[model samples]
Target: MTMSFSPQVLLSKVARERCIANIKELPKFALNDEGSKKTYASVLVPLCVVKEEVCLLYTLRSSNLKNHSGQVSFPGGKIDEGETEIDAVLRETHEEIGFNARDVEIWEKMPIIQGRNKEMIIHPIVGVLNNMNVDNLVRSVDEVEDIFTVPMKELCNIENHGHLKLQREKIILPVYTFGKYTIWGITGMITHLFLQCFLPESLYTNDFMRKKYTIGELMPSKI
Candidate 1:
């Protein structure tokens, strides 16, 4: 079974020892198609505290990009030769958001997921941004359109959660909404996974995410 903890449990203030230790203990998994031959990539599940509440930084992809364009996503990209996932995350995030590896405290890596094209696998790493200042971030005009952070508490709200049921496959893909941004697809799945670990049953249940729906389905994703 996966270990559950409060949202505050991931706060940077108490993350050094027991909290981080427990995080590493959680169940881990990854998705890979046997012998499919795929490229590798990584994205940072960047955590930071704003006004004493834990928040996650996100980016709006530039519409100019060819893949996953004009979408909401964590900063990440294809890994360079001889580079580790940690290095790729640090490098990509730095290139996209001007976040330095020195300021990031990597906690753990969550499950792997197939990327948008099904030709690349994404490794999502959890890390805390020590004293992050969003205003100071320099976004890459060629890749990122805008950047924003959503508090963990807001994500726990039931009103903000939903799913896209794929009729043919009989699978429900998680979805979330924050202001003008609609988070679905791989990004939505990543957020769903991250939130599940932080919320106890009594605090926040993914009722909408887990419930059986008789109607309203979305076709399989193309991007």
Candidate 2:
């Protein structure tokens, strides 16, 4: 029962249905804006699901690396000069994860994520690995320290994890405590957005509603 839907189709459907849902009163966004200010184009978050369940693929970046070192991230990098959003995402995925782009079935891209006036538009691309198993992946030693998969159900489940008010922000975010790593910041924001998009309306419960959805959901795309 592996569920598959065009990314565009799912995003459109979610927007139409949840357009009126009030923003969660969270202070995380304000903190993110104030703490670090950098504009980057296009981020690729890989959504891998198999056997009727969805899982998120993450990488622990090498600690010695510059920028977001030792943080949990998807297989993505900055958009190159003159590169399309899709090109950057696909290219970065190949370079970081060592996976052939041909094996990934990109379903839809989440709306363009805008920050405070930098013209660096971020896009969330959703794709499934042809076979959603660890056996199919090859993590790059240079960029990725380790590659791991967390079941989408665990992420969607409130009992599995909890949120925190970081930097005294009013908002609470889903912080997946994987070992000693806490997935936060933009990656956390993006993860929250996707859960809201894919979880069925009935299945969405308390914590689902408590967490503030990404502002990216409201941001308009150039297309």
Candidate 3:
């Protein structure tokens, strides 16, 4: 049977009653500041219609970079001094992939995500893109190595997802592979949380949420 995954349906189902207010305060672990001072960052989770299916856009980072080099991630970077989270994400998106603020419709701000090392706090802002073609993008050669999208249906496929056991902690973390790119760590956690918004409970059961991760429900856009 064919599945319906239209933008309108997704917007209605994920954004109708959910909002940032539903999320509780940041946990104690996320608030730890005993070590290196935490840095602030933001990312844009872009949803667009591609080839008649809803897909999420991602970028392959240049391998020469100092941090998170050669990994697939959303378009974002550190929030600049005196800049709001939304401003930083939009600016980073433009700088990284030539995706201008005018080309995206701001939707909701997901919960703040703290990096595993406790050195960074990332704010994920969800938005819908006006364009879907990768050829249309003018990526920053110094930052982005490539651009791609994975259909939402593929992400929801249980067969396409798996777990990687952490040797040090003996804990398992979710991992997802799309084409040649493997998404794990902070990106993987964000993806898992985002999928929970619209995916069925039966499809995302134990495997996806074996370890609890904090993320706010989808909120309506004021933009």
Candidate 4:
């Protein structure tokens, strides 16, 4: 597929800006009457590599896992003892996805996003892969069931995604669903917020404003 920006260039811009509004927006989730009162620190990366265009990589957690099992998510995990959030995020990416820390060029970081329970703080890191090929990639079988990628254009285009409310006080965020998976939750919210903050405001044209999504379209694999 044709691409509008060089993966390196776009990531460079995002890294330099390090937009954090979404992270700041986390308190909104906390204040809402959702579930818990605990707070934990975690880091995740929107890992992208340039193919014909930039592609965001994701993983399906093994169904037997404890938290968020079988869900589509970015490569990441909880922060380790004495580790900074960025260091933790980079470290987790390598551990979970087998992405060489050196191969990724960080574009920017979104703000810390809080969990529904207000017990977890999630730092979103955006970066570009230094190389492209399966050989350079890795996945932990215990944590990841499968790894796959989707085009960057599909993500940046607002028309292909939408939001659904889970309850009066809760809403299921929008995400780019490809084939059998739907990118949702904090990852989906981060993706949605990224387009609003980092991409040029002009891309917010009518076409970008009108798209809506459905569960069938978002999770083709579920059916």
Please name the candidate that would achieve the greatest TM-score relative to the true structure. 1
Q: Give the TM-score of candidate 4.
A: 0.76
lDDT of 2 by residue, 144-214 (tens): 88787766555655755555554444755565545455576567777777666555555544363444434
Tell me which residue pairs clash in candidate 2. Answer: 7-107, 7-108, 26-170, 26-171, 27-170, 27-171
- lDDT of candidate 1? 0.75
Q: Rate the local accuracy (lDDT) of all candidates.
A: 0.75, 0.61, 0.72, 0.64
lDDT of 3 by residue, 1-223 (tens): 1355655655564542342333222232256566677799999988877777778898888877888777778999999999999999999998999877888887778878878676889998888888656678889999988888988778877656766555675655676766677666678778877777544554444355433322121111111
Candidate 1 C-alpha lDDT tens digits along 89-186 = 99999999998889998878876787656677888888888878888999999999999998776777777777777677566777777777767778
40-84 in candidate 4: lDDT tens per residue? 455555645645566677778877688878788888788777887
By TM-score, the candidates rank as 1, 3, 4, 2
Q: Give the Å shift of residue 2 in candidate 2.
A: 12
Off by over 4 Å in 2: 1-39, 50-52, 114-121, 166-171, 179-181, 206-223
Once fitted onto the true fold, the runs of candidate 3 whose alpha carbons sit more than 4 angstroms away are: 13-29, 34-36, 202-223
Model 2 error, position 180 (Å): 4.7
TM-scores, each model vs. reference: 0.82, 0.68, 0.81, 0.76
Tell me the TM-score of model 3: 0.81
Selected candidate, larger TM-score, 1 vs 3 = 1
